[model samples]
Target: MTELEADCSRCVGLCCVVPAFGRSADFAIDKPARTPCPHLGGDHLCTIHEVLPERGFRGCTVYDCFGAGQFVVQDLFGGAAPSPAMFDAFEVVERLHELLWYLADARSRPEAAPLHDEVDGLRDRVSAAARSPHDVDVTVLQSRCGALLDEVSGLVRAGGPSLRHADLAGRDLREEDLYAADLRGAVLIGADLRGVDLGPADLLGADLRDARVAGADLSQALFLTRLQVRAAR
Candidate 1:
């Protein structure tokens, strides 16, 4: 797709499926998978398009689908409208795509990287499910995918210089040291912070979902987990 057409308007709101939301510090409401946003329409368009921030949907405004949704729908699914089977595929694919973005952001790649073997294996399973005439159990795929991403994220978070409130989304920082620094309210939507040290630091209300911190240290980080962190930002 051309740059202009590559924008989210061509997609079927896939980002909304890949991740989740709660009444957290970032989101003002709670929502579940495949459930249209109260402001979204049957056409998959946001009704509160212009006033999202004012309407308490700042996270929604900042989301970028990266053309994955349209690619899956038009290219993989043969340009047909989403079927129940396609919808199930969309959920798993969208989630994987979001995780791919997270890994990319954590590693600072200009484009999405190939999934780790573990993740690739999970992708294969999801693919098999997509081919099935009936819907597959996405929960198992979702859980396994989450685990693999977490495993790969540790390698992604390594070797970065100390980052403080860095706009490091979509980059990897596996096993990196960010100890005792200021990261207050940083936009880290798709970052990998696995096994990184964030102790005695300031991460007041930073975004952490879709972010990996599985082996990382967050002890003494002010308002880190105690404060709610939203996904899909």
Candidate 2:
């Protein structure tokens, strides 16, 4: 797995226990916070991992903790038995790791060279926060990272369309030139994007559930997480 990808083998099923979810299109049952999912096994693995979607647990299939599960288990708890405190720290560290993922992606972009130093500094702060999550204000750190990411998007996109927060659900956008488009927070559920090249398009928080992406080129999309890709067809 990559640095930002979850490695469940190194975790203690924290995601299955820490967060709550209601019955919806994503999940088939209602689960309370801090309660283990019925499908979690004694070995810290999902019992229905091979057929989670077929078993009405599509949400779990798309969920990505950005490697926070393993980091918290190995680095924070030192492989000790998970505690309530560890569960609480899991969410905080996940957010920090997400910020780090974005910053690391920005730092790697040749177009964002001018801001690589800033990205590196912010990454260092986020890494520290991940180690000591209780002492850090995640909201402030998110705001700082968001501003820098927006600037990086502008530089890389040059003059792409500003469609942030646009509701384009079920729209057929195969002909749209989405190269470097600012699609932050766009509602793209079920949208048809077959064969479209989303080169460097900012997809932060974009909902891509059930979106048709057959033959779509997202190799260079900015801030596109694995969750979004999994949610798409």
Candidate 3:
């Protein structure tokens, strides 16, 4: 696995300081961007890190910058705490890095093997851009990644089944061969999808609420938004 993992231990707590949130179920208090959290100690660590949910900081639990925080702290700025400008710049880099993850992850699939070099080359460029992302044009980077994904989608969909706009609500789709299926707007609420091979499935707008995902692999799925997952159990 890529060390592209989020190792907050190696970070200067950028996530803790950069984002603002209003009081809600996920947050107990409002904090502005670029402002340090009251819970953040001078050591750049969260005082309630171990018990964030208990402290009503539930939003922190699901947020993953996917190693961008540490990369900015240790690699770009040499382990210094972020200045306001640098902190703001990281938000952009984090978004670009996220696209890198999907691209890098796709490279691991047999379907994407032929595009391995292209994938790696783009990944390298993205990593380099992240090191000094200040004043960088992320739009260009996003376009490039989007183009590559468009090409890769075809290869990924080859020989895979599609269930475009199919209604499978509350159905048992366990161990089904649904690779590369176009499941746009599919109502999958309470569906039993355990052990399903839904590789590269088009889960765009698919309602996955209360759907059982144990042993289910949608890692290669396309267009699966965060909103869909959040709606699921």
Alpha carbon RMSD to native, model 1: 10.3
- Single out the weakest 10-residue window by summed lDDT for candidate 1: 103-112
Report the C-alpha lDDT of model 3 over 29-97, residue by residue, as the tens digit: 999987888998877788998998899987776676767787777887777757876687679878877
**Which scores greater on lDDT, model 1 or model 3?**
3
> In TM-score terms, which candidate is top?
2
> Which pairs clash in the backbone of model 2?
none
Model 2 whole-model lDDT (C-alpha atoms): 0.92
Model 2 deviation from native, Cα RMSD in Å: 1.0
Candidate 3 clash pair list: 162-181
lDDT of each residue in 84-151, candidate 2, tens digit only: 99998998999988898889888878999999999989999999899998978999999999999999
CA shift of 30, model 1, Å:
4.8
Stretches of model 3 off by over 4 angstroms after superposition: 159-177, 182-195, 202-211, 219-232
Error of 1 at 40 (Å): 2.1
TM-score list, all predictions:
0.44, 0.98, 0.76
